[model samples]
Target: MPLGVVIRRQPGVTRWAKWVWRAVAVLPGAASADWQELRREGEAVEYHAATLPLTVYRSETEAYRIVLAAESPSVFVVLHPSEEASPDRPYVVHSVTVSAHEAQQALDSGEELVEPVPMPPPLYAWLADFVDRHHADETFMKRKRGPAVEMQSEDGKGDARIRQAADVYRSPASRRKGELH
Candidate 1:
């Protein structure tokens, strides 16, 4: 049986919209019947896979937080090619994660479908636990520049000796443009 995560969404208002997000529950032990189908293409299809509430750790992204605060919380669902035999199509996704980065990596592999869906919550309690375990308040670090290298020899001049080179800098008119090319 395909595993499922039941997410419940609470109704509310936020400064950015008529609805606010709350992860009210998480049933990790859910059955396939519990997941909602989001979209499908040809033989491939995508499901709610799981409810993983995403979080951003660095403090500098307040604007990002504002955007999140204004919107509903969501989960990333990853699709994989189904193992079962299909006449035309090849795959389906049955897994999910709360990490958008991971979902995107799966999608970028060009082998499966992935999506982000607004989590309806049974997520509240689990969300708290998720936060407690994964939460991070990170600080941004600026990259330091490496030491610059001298373009020439230590004497500040090129050391090569071209004893036999003809005038390579001669005017180009003598050589046909096509030949030069």
Candidate 2:
């Protein structure tokens, strides 16, 4: 399956803080993955996977506002904080929704699917740069030139050398040159 990855930044929010909040919210038997942290513009960014395959960010304001958007879609949402806290926190301040059809249309038209909202420009730029920086470097990969060699000794044979005549020139051996000593 083709996964759409969205990069988001919650100003003044730390990844650990969000993790703590998520741990408190998600009950047992809920399918979830640990949040992954990324650094952009010297600030830590946290991302968690959702059932809708969406990325969420909590606003910095104490109002508990949030921004939700499809990372790969042109759609996004900024929702405001809600009075009651239910299974899901309703602190969405604004939201942007981009339809899959719209995203496909943009791709067909050779346009960028990601559209920036009223977020920090530097953050977006940093994300773009970070993605570029992390792309695998395929240039260093090359085909293998040769196979490894296996070394072994013959069944019962071993390395041996003949003794030189001058080295074995003892009196008794010299007298019986061609004879066995």
Candidate 3:
């Protein structure tokens, strides 16, 4: 499915960063856009950043279900720092995904910014259909433990086999106190 990322650029609170960019919303089945200005208010500007394909995989239906079950079902948009960043644009839309896990991986990188855009109504329906058709219930299998091996316990002693000394628990400092110079 084709998805458009809507980014809002606002004046930064800090002097270092002149402007801050964030993904505000996503447009499902939206036409191609390239930093097209959508709206302007005061110093804040909203742009249709880019249109990227939202791909769903059968194996990732569980992740999709987790996202869909949320109170506000969201599609995660990943943005990476653009090497060719100008004063106007600093980040590039990397990808869009329905799987929360995939989005989480992108977030864990710390380098990329992951924005959760509310899932569109039509996109939600399409995702629900895809999950319903491809998702399979996986059975949980309890892991069996191997036969327990009896081992010797040296409860107040630190491996007696290493040293048969009676003051095994005593510190080396104590031994030094009793030593003759």
Query: Which residue segments of model 3 deviate by more than 4 Å?
Result: 144-181
Worst 10 residues of 1 by lDDT: 18-27
Candidate with the larger lDDT of 2 and 3: 3
RMSD of each: 13.0, 21.2, 6.9
lDDT of 2: 0.33
Tens-digit per-residue lDDT, 88-149, candidate 1:
22334456555445665788899766655565455434544445555466679999998887
Range of the 10 consecutive residues with the lowest summed lDDT in candidate 2: 19-28
Q: Note the residue pairs that clash in candidate 3.
A: none
- Per-candidate TM-score against the hidden true structure: 0.43, 0.21, 0.77
To one decimal, what is the Cα RMSD in angstroms of model 3 from the true structure? 6.9
Best by lDDT: 3
> What lDDT would each prediction earn against the true structure?
0.46, 0.33, 0.89
